[model samples]
Target chain A: MLAAPFQAEFDANSQEFSFAGVVRPRSVDEIAHSISMFRNAIEEARGVLYINVKRLAQMNNTAFHAFSRVVLDACRTRSDIRFVVVTSSVVGWTERMFRHLGKIEPQITVEVYDSKFYPGQAFVEDTSFIPILRTQTKMTWRHERKILPRHGMRPGITMADICCGIGDFAVLVRKEFQPARIVALDHSKASLAYARDVASNFGISDIEYSYGDASEMLLEDNQFDLVTCRHSLQIFNQPDLLLKELYRICKPGGRVYITNEKNSHCLGEPRAQSIQWTYNEVARLFAHFEMDVELGPKSRRYLADAGFDDILVESFMVTNQDGDPQDFADIITAWENVYAGEMAVKRGDPPEFIKRFRQGFRDHIFAALHPKGYAGWPIWAASGRKPL
Target chain B: MNAAHRQPAEPKFEPLLQFEMEMGTFLSDWHHCDQLSTYMARMISHNRTDPLRHSNFFSSALNELLEVSFRGGSPEGRIGCAVYRHGPKERVKISFPCPAGQRQFFREAVARTHGNDAYARYLDALSTDLAPSREVVLLDLAINFDAEIRLEEQDPPSITIVVDLPLEGIVS
Candidate 1:
């Protein structure tokens, strides 16, 4: 369960000693060498020595006792150098535990680093995009409901839907699966508000909508039977970190299910070439924003590399044939606005490029509403079981 | 129902989860304190309003208790942990066979934590170069968590430490 060992590093440039992972040793005897290294770093620091415990998930009282003494003694002796305890709120006890250093000596201070985990949070969290998000979920849910059972989802199991956009899928899964518990978490406060409203209107009292950063979730380890993060991994700059978290929260023998789109593969008959060009551009546009819109087929390699066993991956197409063609058309239209109007414009694309970029989405919409049209949005669904 | 006119229902806590393990084996390693606290926190806190946050706080509090027991108690009998709740309040009861020294430690620590100068004692415990601190961990649960804690003698040489945690709001 302790995948990473306790380690400390000193950066002279930053005047910091950052500690990560579990650091519980019997007395200070086991960690005397590391403490000495930390002490040396503190002694050398001129103005300030920051002791960062942002990733230090757990520390027994024995370890903390040793650490606190070092800081206190340093404050008394090294009057010139100041001490700052940089902590992450992800580990709930850290700020409170380290706050005493600041209280005992004014030279020592504690600061909790909480925000800016998600760079694109502001843009994606805009409430105006919620309509398009709901429509995207609506179309995808049709294929996912059938695909889910094939990927270790069943009734009566505990579930967590990380990055649960607009909470539409959680509602659908709750209605379909009747899970014992469903904790739907998202970084967007606006998205969560919309999701909770939808749940309340539907009289669905079971689903718990929580606000969180998916990459560094406060959720406990091995808590859920099935952990689902749909259409989210491709958007992050670091998908591996997210996969590690998904792997951590899922119980041994439980499955982590994810879905992402290889956007360039989206096809529409009669305007296939135009649609293809637009999606390829869409992939590049997202890449410029540090996101990968073409992470679909790579799902297998990601799960396998993350030490998962019994991987299951499948591709599904949400076509104009499903429920309403307008819904499929709406998803494309919204994509054009965000991708071409917002993302492309932000990338400083010329008018000539933006004009042509907007036309492809219009053609895709026309094809979707056409009598004999077969417009399609391709998605990859993958799941891997955590080894027991 | 109107916001002002309608009366709220009375709060109650019912049995939710309970499990037991051999005290000797569990106390053999310090890591067991973390393992048990983590597993229990994740499994039990899902029913709370905010499961992840609740679990985070619960694990911190529970780990301290488990670690204290690990440091002080004898590995002679069963150590059982039971969690119960049907409302905002959740109760945790950990019962194990204790040596006289362990019992006395809890009695003195609980008394010190409940006194008017509890926060002062906690600060004093932190400032001192106390090895394997007897008071800080228990005092933290009492002061920071706003936990109501007491020790009860179940049988001769066996004792149960009960903690009532109003953990839901403090997290926010």
Candidate 2:
């Protein structure tokens, strides 16, 4: 079984479970106010050197430390500052700063949470994360503008989400887009089960969860007004065949949105060529189908190519959840759970390298999580659609 | 002019003090009013000899200040403060920062440029352009004046003008 790093690892009989009940705050106004305060604190902490240099590389320690001092100060003021209560970048940066600063202020009990993989950095760019921190602002903006959902919502639109791992988008579709029928398919039964639980809790009746290969789902062509494959397109051993199947299943005037890690590889040295190749191949396949190709932020382009014209791709930021360096330590302790087994198989790295790589990744992640704009994960998002 | 206009016992001036105190409290809470003050200050500094004639910037500033302050608080407070926003019908006194000689020259220039029939021509032009939109309001010219007087040898003489813009057009 993959390790669960960000999650608390239980010893056979431990009495200290009081911390488990920390409910992550979801009020956007509060979060925005907190972030603003955090930003201000970072600006004030002009100089300080405290960071974990595990996973990140070639980072500027001086600036990061200075920045993190401010973040740490803000975290200190907010008594409810749990590891998950802030952006991911802040968590990593703060943990490291706390280790150093906590020594000086021994009274400060900074609970450092471990980084789960490089969780805070965005795997795909999306903006839903902003609402996570600045709820009131996002709500106010919504009320002030007539900004529609990126993809238009047509009542009774039957849709399918292939590889709907955890059903993040499924929940959104049900809540915001109000789709009529949704078939969420994924290969992992555990993940599918989890998705099912969430759908049930959200009271989303239209969604039906099934465990199966996403590419092989039995569906007629032109059956869905919208089909979405988010962050799962690159995992296919046979992406070309999968694309063909997706195209075949979509109805005329119906669009498909596919999101994949750019230049994805299961194992090997990571390179720019890999990311570009993913983009290039996807673009080529869509072009061949006579679909008007609009490629850029992966999800946005995918939607556009599928012929959805009113595609909106808003970018959301992801930071180290811990807001401190202990996040790196967390990454070292939790890499297995964070990336799942595929990361090891894909990297083609030896066990020793993998172990060291994980540790090094955490170190860098810690260093990067420093305060100021200098610390934290960098992430971007894209959403597009097909025409009609 | 000073000898003839001298008010008997300065009319007690108690009402003016009360108005000032109330206005000060309002100004302290209303952040946007500072923007108006800055605008007026700059306008007076730039064209100290004349203020009322430069109604474009002054009016826009006042309008923006009123909008932000009105929306910033409860409707009750806005209604209570409406009188301050829409001043009374008495002659509007706008202070300018220039010497008496400069003010006298400016008034003469205005009179000569327009001639005796110019106010009629101005009134005709003003009536033709009173359309309304979501963005801005139009007002009719009601009063115009130019004056020059030395006050304690420190402040400049000034001109003032007034226009009748319905309260309905000035959205809170």
Candidate 3:
């Protein structure tokens, strides 16, 4: 009897129906009744459904779960009906939630757009983005090398890197693991081109570059011996969809490795405090999903639920003390490059404030380096084996 | 007549025909140096009846000079070219107005300091007897060539390099 949180209109020409408005249903009965009406409309119209979640400001977990179950059930029962969820985000945590939902129902597809920087585009064109990614690659490789061998990563194995930005990790795997072949997949052609250029520069010949959404890869099932997604899981619109794809393409007994930053801290500064506050705010926004926005502690549960076995989770801290000053500078530059624009718009910070913060942070970092300035961050590495 | 009394006919010298070209400040990046050099080479070749030989000669010569300049970390500057014809020979001289960074590199190259053996080796590889002086480095193709550096006192101080390539095989 309560008004449904969404309105559905069928387009006769396109043979598709679109749902728009807030989707925060309060109770099971309300969610069910809404799903029933949407399902009946889809069946009657005999067209695809596109749920536009742009105006969907909030969705509680119970309502979201019910909505996902109904959609999946509809897809499973009606072979002719298709469903697509379209969402956009300017912040990291919101993107994570959408991506998580994508994995919940493999039959359903989720499309996410970056509404702020690089709007509606998958590849980032900023000149500074690649350099920052390169710096982060070095930091990540150091942690990855520790556990890769134990997880079936070795010489002569076929590997697929999902969301492999710029092919840095693929090249790293080639150098360290000696994989027989590597297929680096990303959605951004620009990123792929840059990766190919880098691979060419490095004289690496065995990599096959492909561009597509990792959630729905065009790769053969059970083809890869190892699949790895590093530092990208938290930002994916549907981490679960990609994980399912990772599991599907991976050979029986093959392994999948995923790692993400838990938290980053700078020594002797207010910058760390400020960053922590921002992260907390983001986490609070998605508290309904029970997601630990910073560390992504729920990733293990998601992996297990996706039918992975012998799951292992480990944490390590990397410190920037006594490292190259240029590397430290690059880290700071990368942070500013990624978060500055979004944070500026979200927090209404003026240009002067942003500039002062960047300069102040840099000075603080340099000043802290006296008897070895300490800057450190925590990362979580989780891996699981596909059932044979 | 006595052998000394009968003076030998003065060696005939042909009238000098000159060609000049200049590039602007916009095309003054290290990467654009090759492009400008290639353009100069083509211009020299355009006037010759045997375009192939002239093109190959100028192209190789300009490329070698550009390489040495780049290896020495020379700052790219405004480029100019002058071509002169004398009898059966043609001399193509390419000049560059050097900034202080390039001037310093050239001085080190001349002094053979700062572990600059690479530039020295390039110079030695290209030297010939037709070199104007010991200080001048020549790139001796079938055509003879020589390089000279001139320093001028100005507000910022500038160095100029004049490379003279004399074509020997082609007869006009």
Candidate 4:
């Protein structure tokens, strides 16, 4: 039986059928049943059957797989029936899923329509205002010591750094590992330009910079010996798809490294306590667009699901004990700038509230700079190898 | 040789105006370029009303263009523009620093204007179909590395753009 959230309309004359609204069928059996009904309808009518998934926002991996299976099955079984899956651009994960479907079943077509729910171009385009906190809090030396050694980098090994903002990690890898070639991918043109500049300045050659959506990379399959994404997984709307892309590009036995801040642990710190509130508010704001924040612990599971083997997960923290106060101030100021501007304004936060939030953030950072005061965020490093 | 070590030269033209701003903020806001172009157009339209306004607009455009050009690189560097009135027809000369190693990029950008005659096309677009009467004219645009004005040795190399905006009714 078709569930309440699922609605289907058919125009017999036009031979067009559409299913829209929340489609949370109870189980795989229900999805199969639904596909059967669509198959029957397609047999009776002639033209294309449009599956309007624009409104189907909340779909798990199982549901996604089930949908893919049904579409592929239909395409294989019935030659007469044509299917067109329509999705919204704002639902990036859904678009990625449909794209994956197209890859598997070349005959079916998927259309992604632009919607207002999508984050404005301005929001994404403003890459010039990257917070100093991002760099300051990175603890590069620590990452170098811990993560780089495990990679066993050597000559003739090709690597790809997805979400390689400004190519910090790429530069590091080139300098430390002496990799024969490295390709850095990022979505922002401005960021890629900066990365190119950085690479030029460092006299680092053999690093190619490309700009595009990381989820849908233009690189060839099984192109790299290794792949890494640093501190960017949580921001991706569909981290699973990103991981799968990483897996796809990575050669057999090549390892994939993923790292992000442990949000829960970081938010629990006394000096970083306010970050929790801010994160929750930001998450709530993003919820309207159906984007979820990945809170650090899910990296391992995502890697495992992507068919990665020999997985290892490590968590560590960095304290600001010997850190420069000026750097901390700059980080705080950067955070304040972001919060006071688009992040707060987009959420309909009042000027007074933004001002207060900025003040509170500054106060926390100032306190963290004191002798007794301590500041840190839990960092997670998860690496896994593709099956040999 | 570092450019900053040279002795600064005296001004050859009469002082007009100066404008300065951070490049990052300007680039992040998409409307700044349009706002700047509109302001320049207005100043050109109002040149007969006040000749001094021509100098101010030249200074503003020079600063804006430099900022837009140097968006992705180090955001820390400050962009400065100085306008001076010179030449036979009260031409306002504007100069601003650009990032080092970017001279080629800027040169290509300037050369790659939509049509063959960039100045004519720019004037037409800026005037928004207004018949080109005796008003203001863009005389010339050039870029150079003046050793006297280089700010820092370690900073990205600087290229100065010289734009001559000639006011119609004034004789400097």
Candidate 5:
């Protein structure tokens, strides 16, 4: 006699039906009311009717059978109406299970959403970039450990690290906060493999490193007390799509944490002008690839537009002075190779321009290693509370 | 398992997780299927290459089998579920209340899903417009998941069913 922990909503404007939550019932009779509502909605719909089960975390055979019947019957009755069953790759069985109906009914088609939405995933997926990512985190974690508490992180809370590249940040969070549970997800299989290997080698068995698309994730709604997606929103071509998903998974009264870099703001002494020009080009370079390396200051607008409130935004400088200058120099060295060597060449920049760009990174590293020098990379850390 | 269908030298399976409850209690609430399936999937999928993806597939398959146990058999006996693993293969074993006639019905239903025409029959059954209480769990799991299903008669009013799912090896 427990209440059904699921919902179905029909939108007349787009002719889409959304099913969410755990959709299990004792029998078809138990959901006859919702079934009749579905039947009526399809009767008046025209063109394509989208049945979005991307957020439908679980469904039983009884419910699936009932839904299949309704969709197939609707297809047979309305020849003009096409049914598109939208499933998410995060939920493994939905596409395959519903795909059978797509095969049997010509009018029905099943499309998995996450498989196609990762616009700039390739830049971050390279296994060769793993070391730089680790160095970047080692530098940032110092500032983040201080900033995280101001953003609602605490012990024993459920947490999720989306776009958790290589999962070093999640491991740091696990050790520092000791959250009750942590689920770290990323789109890169290679990155996750490395992350899994690192965690296992260290005997850190608590964190769950999962593979998933950031824009259209498979994690359920309102599950995490604190959700962190660091240095990720900028890399995705469609930042809003990724932000919307981050908002969706955050629990009411919880917070979504993010960090992004405005690459042009990078600074160094003794080679200030050259470094400035190169970092600006780095921003432009990322833009050419449909990513925004200069999205740091826009975090407030992004979070507010996604319907979050009590937004807290702060900026931190990861400088050579923060730690060993060697670590900072190493990160810059990797960046030069990827940005000027690979990316500029791919962008078809002149050799002279690539050489000049490479020079700026070399100067920044020089400044980092110089006894009287300073080099800094500024990042914005922002968090917004999901209203209760 | 039938001697005719058993694998020549299947790998040994060690029990990983188990849950036990009376049939009447489990059947009394429909939410158990969802809650239990979600919990078990999360528990068993931690080591897969894609834990989220593997868990989703495992949960879907487990939910279907749990539903079959929920709807079939009498409500006067105990029901138990045990999960076992051998590398990438995961097996779910469920024991539930059943009568002799209901056991025969299940055996015959499972039998229909073994041959080459099983998937086609599954499609046909889906579109046939049977009664409101139509049962097609076995056929769907058997064909869609390529599950290896075995049913064993227990005491007078109970039966145990085992399903082996090679979830990680699947391309999708």
Candidate 6:
């Protein structure tokens, strides 16, 4: 469902949009069917071979906490596990903590991946906070409604969306900045295929969809003027490694933008401390490497500790406005989908009560969004730059 | 007045309407309602051997009357004994072509069976009946004469209900 055939008739006679490999699921059932199709694909896909503690984090909290305590006790004598991926359901919180982690431990690179179910397949995107990113994007495409792209630029610089999920962000990014090169990376064949189809749909060939890890691939480093990591950390257990890679890959004078919301896994005193420690240690590593740093509001102190000189931290909250009923519904539905998906993935089973729980969540949102109901929260954004 | 010009609704129609309403309420309350239909149906059938004075005899008596009318080639084939217990607690049946649907018909039927106060007292008593006390109740089941309630020891109580029925000539 990810690729499409271009129409020569439209290209020759019409000035409308046309491209290659544009995938469109004919119906909702077809979309649901993709889940199993993706599962079969996963069965064939090779495992990267690492411990997924993030999956453990997805377990029921009470049980997970108890298990962690046992693990910690066991580790008292000897460390048993390393390399963890924490599946974070809460976006802004997750992003904030990861940023903080990056600052304190600039040596580690935490790649955050968001689990998204598109059409009939389930895949994880490099983006961690899907709800907020989708919200900031105006709830278009496979979400609430279709919106015309109107993205603002930071300056003269153009940025690329690496591991772009369905290219919703990439499409808007290309539409606005018309970046010199928009390279998107995703290992999932289906996801990359979909992204490629999306790029073709917009008739934008400048944006490239590559199927490999940016850190591992090392094909183009220090090439782009700007590198942006939005809501895509925590997928890497050794985030410290990622920082070095990002540093190595980006141009000497170029800036690396990393953003995430505060996350639940970054909560509780112990979990919080572990995250803080990771950030500080990495920051010390970065300083030892002689790189100037600027920690945004999300990772302020960590960036400072990471030896990032000339640190600049700014905080802006992306909000779902009070009158935006469509945004409200989309957020609730997406949030429930994410949470429900996490539960299913962790349990190693299909969502048993998805239909029932979805109805319950919808009812709850309708009640919450009525003139009698309103709720809002804040999202944290932070950026760190390399020494010029 | 001729039979065609009676100018009044038939007595049989009221009970049927009441039965339909009761069935609708039963389905709506299935998720949270404690009393199960299987248990209530069995209770009615079990009470058939008892005298009319028995507390559970009402449903059984009505069912028996329906059975005879049905066999006699009457329009009332069988009192479709739709038993439902959902109100606060307690098992209650509203048999139609019957009482509870038509106030006059119910009053007359109850008075004929017992006295003027009999139907009023039973209806009033049912309003304040106790809720079911079982921790877990299964609504759908096929039970037989030899039913067993097995309890397991645990902080939270657990029980298993088993029934034995005749399978051919072999009984275990």
Maximum-lDDT candidate:
5
**Candidate 3 residue runs with Cα over 4 Å from true position:** A1-43, A46-127, A264-293, A346-371, B1-172
Better of 4 and 6 by TM-score: 4
Q: Which of 2 and 4 is ahead in TM-score?
A: 4
Clashes per model (N, Cα, C within 3 A): 0, 72, 6, 1, 0, 62
TM-score of predicted chain A against the true chain A, for each candidate? 0.83, 0.44, 0.64, 0.65, 0.82, 0.48
Candidate 4: which docking quality band?
Answer: incorrect
Residue-level lDDT of model 5, residues A9-92, one tens digit each, is 899999998887777777789878878878988987889889999877777777788888998888887889899999876776
* Candidate closer to the true structure by TM-score (higher is better), 3 or 6: 3
Estimate the lDDT of model 4.
0.55
lDDT winner, 1 or 6 = 1
lDDT of 3 by residue, A302-327 (tens): 78988999998887655565256567
lDDT, each prediction? 0.83, 0.36, 0.55, 0.55, 0.85, 0.34
Number of the candidate with higher lDDT, 2 or 6: 2
The alpha-carbon lDDT assigned to residue A200 of candidate 3 equals 80
lDDT of 2 by residue, A236-335 (tens): 4344445555665565566565544332121111232332333343333333332222322455544444444555564332223333434433432343
Q: Stretches of candidate 2 above 4 Å error?
A: A1-148, A153-156, A263-317, A320-348, A367-369, A373-388, B1-172
TM-score of every candidate relative to the true structure: 0.75, 0.33, 0.47, 0.48, 0.85, 0.36
Task: Residues B1-172, candidate 1: write the lDDT tens digits.
Answer: 5889878874567887877888889877868877788788878876565576777778778888887777777888888888887566778888888887677777887777789998888788778755647677778788768888888886758778888888776654
Query: Each model: TM-score of chain B?
Result: 0.87, 0.25, 0.46, 0.43, 0.89, 0.22
**Strongest candidate by TM-score:** 5
Better structure of 2 and 4 per lDDT: 4
Question: Candidate 6 residues A1-388, lDDT tens each?
Answer: 0111211111112221111111122122333333333333323323221212221111111122222232223224333222122322221122222222222222323445443322112323424444444464553322211111111234345455554555567667565546555656544545555655656776756555544444333223465555655544433333444455455455656655554444321111222343333333323322332322222233555444443444444434333334475675666566555544453344343455444434444553554456554333333344455566
Could you report the DockQ of all the candidates, in the order they appear? 0.34, 0.01, 0.01, 0.01, 0.50, 0.00
Q: What digit string (tens of lDDT, one per residue) describes model 1 on residues A1-388?
A: 4434688899999998998777767568998988898888988899988888887867777888788888888888878989888887656678777887788899998998754555554556678889999888888888899889989889999999999979999999998989998999987666877887889899887787776778767666788999999989998889999999999999999999999999999889888898889888999988888888899999999999998999999999999999989888888888888889888888899999999999889889988999998898899999999999
